[model samples]
Target: MTMTMTMTRSLTGAMAAELTSLRDRVLDAAVVCVDRGGLGRISLEDVAAQASVARATIYRHFPGGRDQLIREAVDREVGRFWRDLAVSVRHLDGIEARLVAGLVEARARLEGHALLQRLLRQEPGDIVSVLAESGPAVYEVLATYLEDLLSIERLRDGVDRREAAEYLARLVVSHISVPGGWDLGDEPAVRRLVRRQFLAGVIDGIEPDR
Candidate 1:
């Protein structure tokens, strides 16, 4: 019975791994389609063809159809951006430095991203609407990363790290979405804004001398 149970568990794990790999392949195919012919030109059929999978197989993985697949692809892209940002700021000493570096990197990344530029140019409203719908989830991702940075820097005192992270994340997103009067293009200005507006309260209880 124990051996039988172990074999079952192993099989289940293998199936899960395969499913994950298949999903990634589908998403990669979707990304390729988007890159090749912008967001508005792609369809589930296109994705399936590009992925070399049947339409039914694509639907099996993404039950919500094309929109769901697009959302997941965007999420994966955002996750990759954050991972790259994390690496960019990994060696920075303090949370404040990291925050400044992160914001700068994020702005640069967004401005320079080819896929995002294409989407913005060809299907601006669709991408903007999708981003609005995904705003909370994006904030949560940023806040979670901020929490890790705070913990690592040993600066998670006094302030509610999660709340502070959310606030800071919103601030970053707002700047990205609409510069309004702020010149987000200037790294020095962005750093000053991050330090004065966000990090000040985040490290509120830390001693000035420290």
Candidate 2:
């Protein structure tokens, strides 16, 4: 009886893994469809065709349909952004550098992400809806990260690290919301401007002497 139970559990785990793989394929197909033709042009049938899976299969993985799938895609992309930002933070020593690098890297990344570009330009309404509804989750993650980063970096004596971090995060996200929002032309330019304006300004403006 114990052997039978163990076998059943193993089989269940394997099936779960396989299902996850299939779901990822469907999501990838949806991204490809959106990349090629934009969200308005993508459909359940289009996703199924792109994924080479049955329409029912796609629906089974994402029962909420098109909106839910799109949201999932956006969340996945946002997760990647956060993860990459975290990695980048580890390599830098100063709070200001980390803050600027994170946003500048985000801008470069947002430019290449297909769904993000579409949201920035073509479907601003939907993008706004997502941000309004989903913003708190993003803020929570960012706040936790900033707290840790500030403590470790020991940012300058005068810096209101919390407000500065908040401002920079929001600024980066705002840039993502609008296509061609930052005219920096390159990452270094973005890094320079954000460091000078957002980071330095926050620290300078907060000093008691000022």
Candidate 3:
């Protein structure tokens, strides 16, 4: 019985690994399809063909079909997007500079991303809804990054790191989603604006006593 259990466990582990590999391949193929033909243009058949997998296999992995696959692909892409942003701001001096530079860089990158452009142009409602629904997830990602970059002493009383992170994330997303006549194209102007609007609360040496 012990030997049988060990064999079964090993088999399960191998199967799980294979499934993960297959899922990643499918997601990679889906990303390529999105890049080439945009979100609305591709079908499950297109993804299957791109991944060199059968339709049944796609269904087995992604039972929710096209929508599920698309959501997962977008999630993966968003993670990559933030990781790139993190790297861009990693070398900047101080939390303030990092936040300012990171926000500006994120806005510029998001605006210029081909996938986002296609979605905004071709399927505005769908993209908007997706972004709205994913807001919390985005906040979590940004907040985690901020928590790492920021010192506890810098935050104001009653404002935890998560709250501060969420505040910054919301501020950035709001600016990106709706333009308010500010010249976001100008880096210096953006930095100043960010400092005045969002960073004012979290600036160093402004912490209140507990």
Which prediction has the highest TM-score against the true structure? 1
lDDT of 1: 0.82
Q: Rank the candidates by TM-score, best first.
A: 1, 3, 2
Worst 10 residues of 2 by lDDT: 201-210
In model 3, residue pairs whose N, Cα or C atoms come closer than 3 Å (at least 3 residues apart or on different chains), thus clashing, are none
TM-score for every candidate vs. truth? Answer: 0.85, 0.73, 0.82
lDDT of 1 by residue, 126-166 (tens): 88787677777878888887777676554435778788878
What is candidate 2's CA lDDT for residue 1? 100
lDDT of candidate 1 at residue 162, scale 0 to 100:
80
Candidate that beats the other on lDDT, 1 or 3, i.e. the better one = 1
Per-residue lDDT, model 2, residue 174, is 73
Candidate 3 on 73-126: residue-level lDDT in tens?
878777788788889988987767776687677778877887788888988887
Off by over 4 Å in 3: 1-17, 156-160, 204-210
**Candidate 2: global Cα-lDDT?**
0.72
Better of 2 and 3 by TM-score: 3
